[model samples]
Target chain A: MAHVGGPVRAWRDYTDGAPPPMLQAALDCFVEHGYHGTKIRTVAARVGLSVPGLYHHYPSKHALLVSIVQFAMRDLLDRCESALAEAGPAVEDRFRLLIECLVLFHAHRSDLAFIAASEIRSLEGEARSEHIAARDRQQRMVDEIIDAGVAVGAFGTEYPHEASLAIVTMCTGVAQWYRLDGALTPEELAVRYDTLARRALA
Target chain B: MAHVGGPVRAWRDYTDGAPPPMLQAALDCFVEHGYHGTKIRTVAARVGLSVPGLYHHYPSKHALLVSIVQFAMRDLLDRCESALAEAGPAVEDRFRLLIECLVLFHAHRSDLAFIAASEIRSLEGEARSEHIAARDRQQRMVDEIIDAGVAVGAFGTEYPHEASLAIVTMCTGVAQWYRLDGALTPEELAVRYDTLARRALA
Candidate 1:
């Protein structure tokens, strides 16, 4: 029952905390082995703990997946929101900052970002709802920015909603390929995507 | 042993075949329950066969994943390459056509597309190599188009490689969120992204 439903949250508050170190370890293991291929025991061992001890941290493998997604989205939204707030009154300025926020997040904390996008299907019940809400919350930011821009003639699109999705999709993909050792640093990647985003809307 | 080493294939050709009907069945199960979550038995049963029958079709779950990704990529590459070939000499025309092909493929064959992008890490050895090669071949098409565009002063980007990757990444995310019943049709989405892509590069 994963991948159905749309709901919005308050959107006013999202945590900016780095995912706990265990989440990082679990993210690593999940990336190496598909969620089904990964054993909970392996995650624990990676963190220098036993399987039982791992349960003490998370009740089940599903819980781990849920927590990973929650924190990842939360982290992403927090970054985007802050960036949006920091940028000045102009919609284009805010739009440019949002792209920078997204590309840099994907480039910098790629593993967590990877799980955030790929592991949504594994989420169940409230976890799925909560995660989707966080995603929609992020999408809503893009939608609002675009909508606002369209209203003021700052942006022009016959398909404003799809434009938002395309922007997020494009920015999110940075995680799939970005590497610390890669040719372009996160700052550089963000700059390039920023240029692309401007051209897309212009 | 997943995610290792790259090799080039004879990239002389690619075809856009309708994925076999059987692929649809497998893609469903994989989406509901990721590669590891799916069972050979369940997949076979879905097709009204014994586990052994499924084994006759695919040697292992990993094999199943490899086939899915290869076919899905083939389908995508087929579409993108054809569009790239068909659009007139202008880089902008080719680029616009390329966006339409990608957006449409991801919108229509979303489940398979999801598995194709998300399940790459589950493959190992030659399977992984083959799939990445197919992907690189597709990326090479984008790179060539962008390089030619820049060479001819049709497209202007300081970072050609990152722009290509970002374009693919943005276009690919349509699968994760698109619905046939959603507000925008594939054609509409493509038109919108085309505008965005042009602006980004302009």
Candidate 2:
């Protein structure tokens, strides 16, 4: 299912822009502890800083989470756009590339992906709205690809909208279970996901 | 497709063997405030009890989370077994029944399902191990069905294990997005998913 010709970038490339060391440590804490469960003090402590020092960097734990989520979402969006642009002229090729990118992102950056997937409930107001907006944009990317494919009679599913959401959700879920010591590399997993997704779309 | 035969129970029917009302109340708090985020006092207040009274029922927050996860997993397992039995002799029928049962469980008991999927990280020792065992058993049921279908030339996928995990994850994720006011009924959603999953398995 992989693209056979031209330069194709993997989804693992997107997470290169990571948070700062302090924020990264804080994100790890947030992933292990629910956002509500994490304390600024604990996050600071993890990075060898006192509570007051941590406060200097992040006004609150909430700020840290907001930054982490926005970063992950934006990074993913930016990468998807780039990858899709270079995914050749075929709609099927573009769709497969999107799946590969999504699967790779979820597998490679499981922590950030986990926070994005599971902790949205802890966000509030503009933060929550912004995250949802980003998420919707991501869903739209998949939906549009399906539409493009359907336009060319390349794919058919009765539940187009629901199928879009299902495909996105299925790929995002790789973060929940993909393991470092497991059998497949991130690339291999992405290939398999792309294949399975093709089955769904076919 | 809901079973048209004798009474086909919803997956939530299994969770009907609910915890005590107080523990149930505590579960709501845990779902919102999270395992580390929730205090015994909050659970008690939600149920009109003192912290000491809450402690009288369940020793700690950890206990509450463990109870909730185990209950949800066991309940899902029991219902799936019953559903598969009545799903008849055809592998395709059995596969469709699994998706219906899974979609119904996730939609009806979303909170419990969410807690089970996202909070395993909060559990420790035997609780975590037992919950994972139950989850694995659920995955194995899905896998065995796929294997049966493949044996009969009813289904085909090169990555059987990965496809099984993907399908289970995809179905379980309905809990995260399925809303009571959404476009589809639980039954409607189940049929759509069974259709989509059949595409993947094809």
Candidate 3:
């Protein structure tokens, strides 16, 4: 299968490795102006590509938006899964790893952070449902960690699901105010948030 | 002072009364389809009034949006202050009260939550600055409570400000997903969140 001008390839297959720059430009524009407010022309201009050239890469503006979100979600989930596997079987370590992933995830992909926090609702039909399911799965992973900790007497919680939600929300909220140029590095923020989560769950 | 329709009553005063059926209609519209997307005529029609009648109560659509945010912010801050006073000088009690107020605030004024989270940036110049200051002041109150807790050794944290920000973000994030018809009441959610905060700081 030749990776030519196809919707799936334009969105998913970056084997040729040219789509990342376009996606990066789109992410920045979308974060600043919102999905509905952003225009393909602006993204193209930012990337130094003609509008038609941009369309050669992405069939439509919505396609670009969806691809950005889909790629970011997949990337985040993949990182968390790996972190969980590498952190081994301890529930506390797993939770800490997840929190750390969240902090670094937000730091590296602030554009995705903005979209995940603000633009998910704008997605429609299957895309919307898939995004919601992905988000719920992420939430459920946190819930499972908390529940396991509670079950084994490693973590104490009055309500595991609510506690999990609060923890995740607190960590994800870092994306709103965190600055790469600011005082703390993503690693430091992760450590701080991990401490906060441990204390919250303790 | 007569509470009837007149310029003698500021926008703040009108919010104290019934909130006019039209304003409620407008809020619903604004929340459903953002501030920029809502039409004045639609708001009027929802409340069974002429557009001019809607304009009579609010000078313009921009004023109406600002009024909604201002009213919600004032109400939330007032509740926080009242809770603080009623809870007295104890750090733990103040923290608990603040969380309780936050849960209830998010539950009651979900439209305001949507607007504050998504639309405040639309306001320009003095209006925007005023809203930001009010938001910062609310945050500072939370910080003060956390600092007091740290000072008294009621809370275990070297970074009181960061802990306070995390707690506030966690609580506010509830509004994004909370439903009145959900399994947990606002008070129940508050208790759950309060426990999480205590643990995180512990």
Candidate 4:
């Protein structure tokens, strides 16, 4: 079940590419003002573009949100896959690697992580389902790895499904409270989370 | 460290009282439209009152948000105290009971929990600080329990602070994904989380 490479291959790598200025402006607006509170006009003004000019790129406010969320997810998935590739076939190693990747992603990209977690409600229809599916995929990955660990006695949790959910939830929560200026760097936080994740399954 | 009667005595008990209709209407609007997206007029319309009539009861949209968030936190804190009171003197028992209470609250009161978690950013000035202080109090309770457990050698986790956070994060996350119609009742979900919480500290 621990396939080396699959869906992660399909995601475009935006790891190094900063969001275009317009998208960043929209994201900042959405962050400061909830998605519903933010106006396309506000995004346009922030980006120093006309409404039409902003629309020329993003089409709509909803489109900008989708782009931002997707960008965050893709970069995360890309990092996850790369980490897993180097983790080899040991389930414990893969588990630790996955958690580290998640903690780092949530902490290092706290704003994007916060938006992705908070604004899922604002997404509608197919976009909502698509976003949920993508999120479920991430959860499923965690579940599978945990399940495999249990299968091989590499992990000891009886409730693999719940453990996976809890681990992912806590990791996602790093976005909620993690401050870049805080005592722990993202790497230190990742190490701390790695230990906690293991204890939850150990 | 586990002082029982201090803060709990000072907090008003709203555990059995549902929020008033106007506040409920405001909460519904805030939940549907992010705090930024909701209007006082909309909440007024939902409750069949004129704008000034609504303002007479609740001064502004911000006031509504603050009231709703405070309601959620007070109820949670009240319940946490009651649970802790009955949990006896053992650190592990208190730990289990606290997690159970959190899991149950987030699952049963998913809407309030969701708003409390998601809309904290929408709060401003003193309201934001007050809300956060209340929240940190809850975390500190967990931290104190974990630290006590660590001191007694009942909990093996070296990273007590991180473990406390991870446990609370996972419990709060129940609000995001829990559905009443889902397979698990709140009690059942609470048991699952209780096990995971112990595993994290074991």
Tell me candidate 1's interface RMSD: 1.5
Task: Give the per-residue lDDT of model 4 (tens digit) for B70-131.
Answer: 99898888889877887889987898888978987887777888788888878999999999
What's model 2's TM-score?
0.93
Candidates in order, TM-scores: namely 0.87, 0.93, 0.85, 0.91
Candidate 1's residue-wise lDDT over A66-180, tens digit each? 8888778877777677677677788988988888788877777788877777778788899888988888898899899999999999876766777788788888888887887
Candidate 2: residue A52 lDDT (0-100): 90
Q: Is 1 or 2 the stronger prediction by DockQ?
A: 2
**Which portions of model 3 miss their true places by more than 4 Å?**
A1-19, A49-53, B1-22, B37-60
TM-score for predicted model 4 compared with the true structure: 0.91
lDDT of each: 0.77, 0.83, 0.77, 0.83
Candidates, DockQ:
0.63, 0.73, 0.48, 0.67
- Model 1 chain A scores worst on lDDT over the 10 consecutive residues at A1-10
How far does residue A106 in candidate 1 sit from its true spot (Å)?
0.6
The residue-level lDDT of candidate 3 at B28 comes to 83
Model 2 misplaced stretches (Cα beyond 4 Å): A1-16, B1-7, B10-19
> Ten residues in a row with the worst lDDT in model 3 chain B?
B6-15
Best by TM-score: 2
